[model samples]
Target: MDFHYHSLPDLFEQLGLPAEMPAVEHFIERHHPLPAAMLLADASFWSPSQASFLREEVLGDADWAEVVDDLNSRLHH
Candidate 1:
């Protein structure tokens, strides 16, 4: 399979969110510091579809995994 590099903005766009850097940063700032015990895919701010995409991509280690993981880290900080 061919591999494609996905950035944070790409992930956001795939999730149907605002994909601009400023919007992404604002989103992180608004929802950040996620509880240590909370799963990123279980975060309340995500729609069910968005959450499912995150969960599946990470679990499957798909093309979106790295960028999804990056987003997970940012949200927890």
Candidate 2:
């Protein structure tokens, strides 16, 4: 799917993580306000390649920047 528009679950699924609504909700509630880059770099569930692709490809690309920003906002207080 193009990263132009995505729901939180879609975004998480694309990132190779669990995208179940409750799981995502709990994760966010448990760890809201996560710094995008730091979380991506440090989260053990994500492989190095996955994190790099997300940080350098999705986040770095202008086309997907909006999606990344939205995720960041939801993550932060």
Candidate 3:
């Protein structure tokens, strides 16, 4: 079966991404759902460093701290 990323980034422009960076084609020859969601659902192409840059740019370090806390809280639950 063929599949493609169908995430918010692909649907909205407010995310500021190129609108075509993320796709299932990179992972599977025939296309498929992302192997994992959390790692692939959001803009799908973000690197760790790039994520940190975006966080710092959009949320600042203090806000990024809260974001981390929130993510940790959700993960632990």
Candidate 4:
């Protein structure tokens, strides 16, 4: 069997995540490409905010944690 991989940006596009954050673009440029095809294939779900946290925090600095936390709180509550 053969498998193909897609980057996080491509996966986000496919999954319909908002693509507005430039910081996220810069982040994706530096890190390893995500296993997007696999992530998408999984039936699990993510709230938009959760996905945003993964994108921003996973690739970004610790300072971004504050922003993500604030946003997460707003989203959940």
Specify the highest-lDDT model's number.
1
Model 1 lDDT tens row, 35-76: 988999999999999999999999999999889989989988
Task: Report the Cα RMSD per candidate.
Answer: 0.7, 3.6, 12.1, 14.3
Top candidate by TM-score: 1
Off by over 4 Å in 4: 19-77
lDDT of 2 by residue, 1-46 (tens): 4546667787678778789989778877876766656554355656
List lDDT for all candidates, in order: 0.92, 0.66, 0.38, 0.44
Compared with the true structure, the alpha-carbon lDDT of candidate 3 equals 0.38
CA shift of 30, model 2, Å: 1.9
TM-score of 4: 0.27
Q: Lowest lDDT 10-mer window, candidate 1?
A: 1-10
Shift in Å, residue 75, candidate 3 = 1.1
> Which stretch of 10 consecutive residues in model 4 shows the poorest summed lDDT?
34-43
Scored against the true structure, residue 36 in model 4 reaches a CA lDDT of 39
Q: Which residue pairs overlap in candidate 2's backbone?
A: 33-75
Q: Which ten residues in a row have the lowest lDDT in candidate 3?
A: 23-32
Tell me model 2's lDDT, rounded to 2 decimals: 0.66
Candidate 1 regions exceeding 4 Å error are: none
Q: What's the lDDT for residue 70 in model 2? A: 66
Clashes of 2: 1
